[model samples]
Target: MQPHNRRTFLALGLLTLTAACTGSHRHDPDGGDQRPDPDQPVRLRAVAATDTLLAAYDALLAAPGAQTALLQPLRAETARHRAALTAGTPSTPSTPPPTTTSPTTPPTPTTPAALAVLERQTAQSRLADLGAAGPPLARLLASVAAANALHAAALGAPAEPPAPAATPTPTGTTPGTSAPALQKALSAEHAAVYGYGVVGAHLPEDQQRTDARTAYAAHQSQRDAWQRLLTTLGATPTPAAGGYRLPFPVTDPAGAVKLAAHLETGLTTVYADLVADLPAPHRPAAATALRDCALRAHRWGAPDTPFPGIPDPTDPSPTPTTPTTPTT
Candidate 1:
């Protein structure tokens, strides 16, 4: 199978599970007390929100002297978010239906930084919408939220201060079930910690080296956290491999930047899986981590993807899907 196709399946695997679990209940009037699918309203609100964002993009792009070079990529990402959110729904047409913005609507901010504030607001709303969704919709909403966060960074918005860490809940664990996914996440964190060491070594600029060092330290902290979480669940965490092979040779500063992007992009995918597989209480952490990965990946020159961790079918040169191999 093609690599991107496999990545797509990994990303959407939970949706298939969600469908099988819910499909039998759809037409059961005989059961007498039918409740509506809880995800429907949340999905609708998300779709509406994306439409508003697209309108803002259209307004910003149409304005005189707009910075198309920067704004256009962000806008393109927003469009892709819209497509992902509405993917399997009945109302989605093969061709996008025409859309028009009302004259009464206020114009979007002319400055890119100001526009980024709106992007951040959209991201917050997506997170807010997460509470009511089932696993399938929740995963998509998490990706959308993270993608908007990346868009905000792309537009030069100041980073919001990190939220205080919530105590990890043990609700998602079932003897052997959550262990494998948690272990997968831990394993990826292990790679990131090692990869950043290489990144720090090869990067030439002082500021870039400092950034690499900071990323390395952050991964260490996350790696340790995952270890503790696994222990708390009575599972052994996977130990870091002695060494990891770089997907591509990191022989220069340019290569270091690409390697950093590659590492974070891979972590983003692992966390996205945790968001889907773990319980609701655990999802916010996964979502936040996913956003952090997306932001760091973009900072290191990765092309902006609408669904940050998930491979974009539209991308000709998608990131590799397999975990980096360990070298003895």
Candidate 2:
């Protein structure tokens, strides 16, 4: 095995052992204390190992000149490991609960529900990781991790406990129309594409210009996809404006970098909105895409905006403006 692969396996093995030593403790969604139970199956250790292995494979794929031949085999191995771990604890009806010694102590619950929850949580975490991580590898990892998370959730074993609200169906401008979140997202994409053009124009050198151009193309591709989706749903996409106002002057390379960063931030927020508004089956894709943007933005040195889930401070103003646009 390659040096990286060998190291990956060794690391995963250590992780598994560490988890085993800790015993099974379900993380309370409410941020309460863990309910530790020795009887709880240590399946999480194996599941975690699978995650590490998959992550390692992702890193390898991210490297330059990675072989397709290696990728397929690595993916296959990951799948096999996942299957083995999943099979060990098939979902079954919850058995009659045994009396627990304490609230902090988990009852000797049956295998199925716990396992299902673990799988779902794993998937969700992976998707979140994908969003937080950087680059070509980030996208690939996010895609796979999101898929796994969905699968785990479907198995009725969610890593995180379900929220009180039932999963909301996608809603939009009109009742039973495209989701509102999606419409907002399309607008955001339009803004990002426009912003990139403005920012790219001011880049000082050939390399900076080329990088901006490449990023612009990616945004365009995303914009086109959103547009197509909107058209299919009978909604008109938000048209790109003639001139998007920038938050600051793009008079120098630093200014160009700042503009690029802002564009990335916009893209991330838009993608996140899409993820939340999409129906369950479609959500994973949106989430993965949004994460990709966020990771990229981070790499580009964008200041982390407050989590978009929170109400924007400027929302109440009649003229809610973004950063000041640089006048030519």
Candidate 3:
């Protein structure tokens, strides 16, 4: 295994051990006090990590020739992350506010590459914590980690090499359990495969067509995997609709690119839910899929969000409309 993969595996094992040790407890009878929440430390650590990254962005933006156009969107995304992490966890006697570093007077030598490294490290750290977190927080951490991974790539950094997927263990369980989430993901992949065909047709550029083909192939593969998993689980995978109604018209290349972004953004949300639903050992694949979709969405000009799969409560925009399924 690669050094990073080994490190991640060790970290996850450690976190799992920690969770098992501390996750379940009752009121302290000796002092008649409540036990501390086990997830708090993990949450606080994540908040601190995000704050540090946000400060780095501040320092870099303060420096000369910082490429505001490129960095600004990323920075904004970090702020959204901050908001999400800090929402219910307020500063108190026990939990202090996350410390933020003021930009230095001269500001340290900060570059996009350095920031990308930070993003990658932060992402790994969050991934490590996944095993220790509660279902909701674990889902959030996975989403943020995925976002940071994409952020690293957007900064021109080498992509984080893919981790090996865990071997599937089909229990022959029914749809009332985790199989439903997998089925949902399969449905999204189906729509994505269909949408990419439309996108490829409208994209005039060779590179765009190539990207479309790659995305199409990827979705098809994912769809097949979901089907296999469902079959093993004794659940029937839903058949793809004859056609999906597009949310908007796609008559030109610009429109095609928009559709592509839309496809990925929708998939990210589906996979994020899968992250929360799957068993700990299996969650990594769903998280990776979420990250992949988020990166594709970013490249296709989708607006960045701190939480890729989950909707940000801070945004007041109306709920996004999903593609309607028409009868065959």
Please give each candidate's TM-score: 0.77, 0.45, 0.74
By how many angstroms RMSD does model 3 differ from the true structure? Answer: 10.6
* Best-to-worst lDDT order: 3, 1, 2
lDDT tens digits by residue: candidate 3, 1-328: 0011111100111001101011123345465656566677887888878777877888789888879999999988887776766554434223334444466322333889988988988888888887677767777888889889888988989855434333256543323488777877777776677777778878866887878887777777778888887787778998765545566787899998998888888777777777777766567678878788888788798887777877664465556543333323
**Candidate that would win on lDDT:** 3
lDDT of 2: 0.46
- Candidate 2 lowest-lDDT run of ten: 11-20
Tell me the tens digit of each residue's lDDT in model 1 across 1-328: 0111111101112111111111213334465654555566776778777777777777788999978898788787777777666654544443344565578433566677777887888888887766577766777788889888888887888876444333366764434577787787777776776677677768765888877876777777777777887898989899765444556676898988888887777777777767777666677777877788778777788777777656552345635434233434
Off by over 4 Å in 3: 1-36, 62-65, 91-109, 159-176, 315-328
Better of 1 and 2 by TM-score: 1
CA lDDT of every candidate: 0.67, 0.46, 0.70
| Deviation in Å, model 1, residue 314 alpha carbon | 8.2
Query: Poorest 10 consecutive residues of model 1 by lDDT?
Result: 1-10
* Reference-based lDDT, residue 54, model 3: 75
